[model samples]
Every structure is written in C-alpha cells, then in structure tokens.
Target: MAEKRTGARKSSSDGDDGASSRKAPSKKAPSRKTPAKRAAPKAEAPRRATATQVAARAAQQLLELTGKEAEGVTGLGRADDGWTVEVEVVEVRRIPNTTDVLALYEVTTDDHGDLMGYRRLRRYTRGTPGGE
Candidate 1:
C-alpha cells in the first residue's frame, strides 16, 4: 500500500518557497504614451466703470479734496482713459439754511475708479436757481 503525506503538499502552480534558493524572471506589459493636458484660459477684467460706481467715486473724491461733505453727484461722463464727473460739495453753512453756499466740481478718474484730478467749476448759494 502507498504512504500518505502528513505536512503541506506542493502543487504545480505554487511559486518557489526559498527552500531551493532560486528566483523566477519577472514580466512587465509595454507602456503606452499619452497626450499632454491643456491649461484653462484666464478670465478678462472690465475696462469701464458702472453708473453707480462713477457717481460714488466722484462724490468721495470731492469730499477728500475739499474737506467738506459732498452734497450729491450732478453729472457723469466717460472719457478716453477714465471718467468725467460733476460733484456738488457744501462750501459754506449759513445761519439761514437757504443761504448755504455750494460748489460744483468736475472730477476725473481712471478706469479702475481711482481719482486722477479735479477742479471747481463754479459756486452758488443753496437758494440760487440753475447755480447761476
């Protein structure tokens, strides 16, 4: 009769167990070349200012220059490099509210709403008509 094995048995698919002190050569698949990825386009910036922004900028610049608060924005226009704005500023306060003096200033700013320069066009009392 044949004798039975008592320990682990070896199989045909089993790899080297280091008992034989031998190694098997490794195999690798061929590498594939891929195309490079493209970068996303950059966003563009605005070249002009909005009506609200223009008005606010004009009033702010006027107050800074004259040290008096701005009454309001009277006019706004777009120029080659920036904007043309007309701002009304309180120049003098009188005992009679109706006699208070006001000044109209023309302001210029860059495309980014930065003040470039300004000049006072005329002055008038609060009760005056058409600033004349």
Candidate 2:
C-alpha cells in the first residue's frame, strides 16, 4: 500500500476569536484490482526474544505510534509497526468499537523521553478506563 503523508498544523492556543480555519478534504479515487490467489508462505522464522524483553519492547513500541504513554494505556499487542496498545482517549469519537478505538500513539525519542514523531494505527476498548 502507498502511504499518503501530509503534515498538519495544530494551534496550541485555546483562544476563541469566533474565527474558523479549514480546507477541503481530499478524497482518494478507487481503482479496479484483480483478485489474487490466497496462500500462506511456507517459510518459518526463528525465535529471538525472551519473555521480559518481549513485554518491555511491546510497551516501548506502543508509545511511539500513539501519543499516550504506557502510564495511561494497557493490553499491548503485536501490530504491523511493532505493537498495538489500548487506552481511554477523549480525542476519538465515543462510538462502540469501529469509531472509539483509543489505541496508544507511537513516538520516536532519544535517550531522554523527548517525543519525536507519533501516529495512531488502530483503536480498541481493551484495558481502557473503567476496563472498557
């Protein structure tokens, strides 16, 4: 899949001057595709992790994709990027499952806990506030 990357600016000010700033949303055009045979790969990979390392790595990976730190999130899992963490977030629309998937954001940082880049991949209700 091709990634459409675009940068957006979010104002940090909470001032309300009765003004609006918006742009027309861009729509992606769908293209026809041919169905391909579905078959599993016959190759296997070797193990390279211990139990403790696995859990710690999972938590770190979650912090990168979703902005939420591990402090407010739980139920981490393996995602395409590295991990998927669930959290109770208000930014997401409060729907049941499809809409309210408050997954932890992933962010890159240095030795210090300074945030670099982050984005959310998916949302789930597991381990959310009130235990979802």
Candidate 3:
C-alpha cells in the first residue's frame, strides 16, 4: 500500500498553507490638528452716581469734615461734572426741641460720589421758617 500525509501541507501553486490564504483587516490611529486662539473681551467704563447716592455721600463727608451728625437731605441738584447736595445738621442743643439750632451745608461731589468741597450756608433754629 502507498504512504499518506498525516498533517496539513503547503500548496505548491501559491507557496503557502491553506489557513494563511485569508488575511486580517489592518488597524491605524486617527489624525489630530492644533486648536485655534480666541480674542479677549473689552472692559466697561464706570457708571454715573444717582441723586440719592450723591446726597448720602455729601451728608457722610460733611459729618466727617465738621464732626457733626447729619439730620436730613434738604436739596439736590445736578451739575456739569458732578452734583450739589444740601445737608442739614444740628449745630447746638436747647431745652426745647424746636429751639435747637441747625445749619444747612452745601456739599459738592464728583459724578462718582467723591467729596470735592463743603461749606455751611446758614444757621437757624429748628422752628425757623423754611429752616432758614
């Protein structure tokens, strides 16, 4: 009887084994790109002060300058560069509340509510007409 092959053998026509005839798909990494730059935002300007803010600042500054307590805001007016505020303060104490002496101060401040200057306009008793 003739001898038979026991295991797999290469094909003479393709020079490879039967299992190596089919190949696996190839694998590759994806490409990358650099990021773009962005521009910075602009800054905002300072805002103007309101009538109430200006009045409060004027009263506070007057108290600091004269060492007196502010009683109330009597007047407020807008200027070209800032504001003019009139503040009332007690200058002297008396037995009767109505007889107490008070003073009106004209306070000037910049648009940002910074004290520019201040001066006492007039002095009168609490019961005086129009607080004059």
Candidate 4:
C-alpha cells in the first residue's frame, strides 16, 4: 500500500515551499508629460475720438479757459496732431439778445478729445450777417 503526504508540496522553480511563487504587482506611480506653453496676446491701438466728441470737448474747454458760455459749434475737422473745432461764444451780454457780442474760437484737441490750445478767430455782434 502507498503512504499519503500530510504536509504541503514544495515548488522546484525557486526552491520555495508551496506558498505562492508569483511576485505581487509593483506600486510605482506613472510618469506624466508637461504641457506646452502658449504665446501672449497682442495689445490693440487707441481709438480716435469722433467729431461730435471733439467738438463738445473743445467747446467745454473754451468755456472753462475763457469764462464765456458756448453758443454753438460752427465747424469741425481733423488736424495733423488732433482735431480743429470752431465754437461760437458770447463775449458780452446786451439788453437786446440780437445785439449781444459774440466770438468765434478755433480749438485744437488730441486724439482722446483733450484740449491742446484755442484762439479767437473773430468777434462780432449776434445780429451781424454771416458772423463776418
């Protein structure tokens, strides 16, 4: 009769006893690739002021410097450095509204509507024809 073995059998490969011979999976972390850098956005140029804005700015500035009330804007155009605006203002008040003294001022302003300079072009009564 053959005798039965009571203990576990041994593995011949690594000379290990009949515990698991396979190694546990490694716990190492995965390596990551860095992202590429992006280019910076370009800046925009400043916008020029509109005719209406330039005219209004010129009138207000003339009033502040001359201490006279602006009556109206007669002419507006672009200049080499900025804008040229013609503004009418009351220089002297009179009993009759039509006889009041008025002046025409040429005002210059920058691209952003900031007044650079101003000069009186002509002066006449409000009743004068064509302001000549």
Candidate 5:
C-alpha cells in the first residue's frame, strides 16, 4: 500500500501565512492649524522725466507748431507740477547770414515727458552776442 503526505504544518512557529506576523496599525491624533493673513500691496508713485527726454520733448513740441527746426536746448528744470526746458529755434531767415533771427522758447512738460505748453521768451539775430 502507498502512503501520501498531508503537507499541513504541525506548529504555528513553523508556518508563515502573513496574518500572524504583522501588528495592528495605530490611530493618529488630528492636527489643528490656522492660515496666516497676507498684507495688501501699496500704490506706486509717478515716474519723473530725464533731462535728455525733457529737452527732446520741448524741441518736438516747438517743431509741431512752428514747422521750424530747433537749433539747440539751452536749459532744463523741474517744477512742482512738471519739467521745464528752454529751446532755441530759427524764427526768420535774413538776406545776410549774420542777420538771421533766432528765438528762445520756454516749454513745460509732465513727469511722463508729455509736452503741456510753450511760449517765446525773446528773439535775436544769430550774429548777436548772448547778453541780451
């Protein structure tokens, strides 16, 4: 007669079914946290114009009205409201080259280099000296 093996483990320590090897999972405590508050952004100040930009704006404004070209920029300044620039322009052409007439104009512009207004300060000939 042939005898067949049953294959069953005789002791708990000799077998590993996984359920007897692991411990129960522990419970974790709940966390209590408050979200932080954010600060509001501030408003930015207006930007000021540069000296070069101010002079260029003045010349452009003068040319837009007179059609005459600007000769040079004489002065630049800043006021409470905006910037100021002094520009020289050729007003009238004369027969003799020394008799050519030139004019000094005061131009005002905003902080952003926008031309606001302009006015003629004085007129003189090209050959005339600076004191007048």
Candidate 6:
C-alpha cells in the first residue's frame, strides 16, 4: 500500500512531503561576451617569387633574336660584363624539348658590365616578362 503524507499518497512507505517542499529549477540566459576578453588576431607573411621567374626572363630575350618563341634558357650568372643572362632558346618549329635551342643572352648593364645574381630557371616559351 502507498504511504499517505498528511493527505497526499506517495510511493515511499515513509510519509515524507518530497513533492510539496522542493521547488522546480529555473532556466538561465547565456552571458554576454566582453571586448577586453576577446582573443588576439594573427599577422600575415610576405610573398616571394618562384625559380620559374628567372627562366621566363631568359626565354623572352631569345625570342627577340630568332623572331619566333624560344622554349628554354640555362646559363645565368655574371661574366666579363654587366649582369649576364645566357638563355637557351628553341624556335617553335622543331621539337618543343629539342636540345638545338639557341642560347641567347639577356644582359643588363650597370653602366659597366659587372655581376648581379641571376637564376637559370625552367624551360619556357619566349616573351616572358621582366620578373619581380
């Protein structure tokens, strides 16, 4: 038999007033975020050019000589003169990868031919722009 607490009947045999004495829990709203407590932002890095930029410059020079596009260039360094850019070039007629490409030079002078660091980059079609 169910136990009766004063007037109400309960499942427990002890006549304790559990349902009458306890109150229901209330729901709370989320707290607002403060600007002072926010996380710090990250900084960005500077960009750099790839090795391909050098080869393109060399190929562009070769095209001016042959009247057609050159495919690639190789030797890049300082010589007896100013900034020396020796480029190997193949006209568009022969095999694209032919070893017969003429090595045309694209040299920049410092008023007196001297050494500036240069890169003999990848094989490219001629008319490549002056790189950054």
Note each model's CA RMSD in angstroms: 7.0, 31.8, 10.2, 10.0, 8.9, 12.0
Which residue runs does candidate 4 get wrong by more than 4 Å?
Answer: 1-44, 130-132
The digit string of per-residue lDDT tens for model 1 on 1-132 reads 123232233332243565455555658766564444424445568667787898897788778777988988888888998888999888998988789999889999888778999999998989688824
Q: Compute the lDDT for candidate 6.
A: 0.44
Tell me, by lDDT, which candidate is best: 4
Clashing pairs in 6: 73-88, 81-113, 81-114, 82-113, 82-114, 89-101
lDDT of 2 by residue, 35-99 (tens): 55335454655444543445455456554554444645444344443433343343454446455
Model 5 has an lDDT value of: 0.80
Return the lDDT, model 3, position 52: 89
lDDT of 3 by residue, 6-88 (tens): 22232433456543765646576564543443244445567888888889988988888899889999999998889999999
How does each model score on lDDT?
A: 0.79, 0.44, 0.82, 0.83, 0.80, 0.44
**How much lDDT does candidate 2 score?**
0.44
lDDT of 5 by residue, 21-85 (tens): 86548677665543443244455676676888778977997899889789899988988888889
| Candidate 1 Cα outliers beyond 4 Å, as residue runs | 1-47
Per-model clash counts, in order, read 0, 9, 0, 0, 0, 6
Q: For candidate 3, give the lDDT.
A: 0.82
lDDT of 4 by residue, 1-132 (tens): 122222222234434532256675878877554444324445567788889988988999899999999999999989888999999999999988889999999998998789998999999998778724
Better of 3 and 4 by lDDT: 4
How good is model 3 by TM-score? 0.65
TM-score of each: 0.65, 0.26, 0.65, 0.65, 0.61, 0.29
Inter-residue clash pairs, candidate 5: none
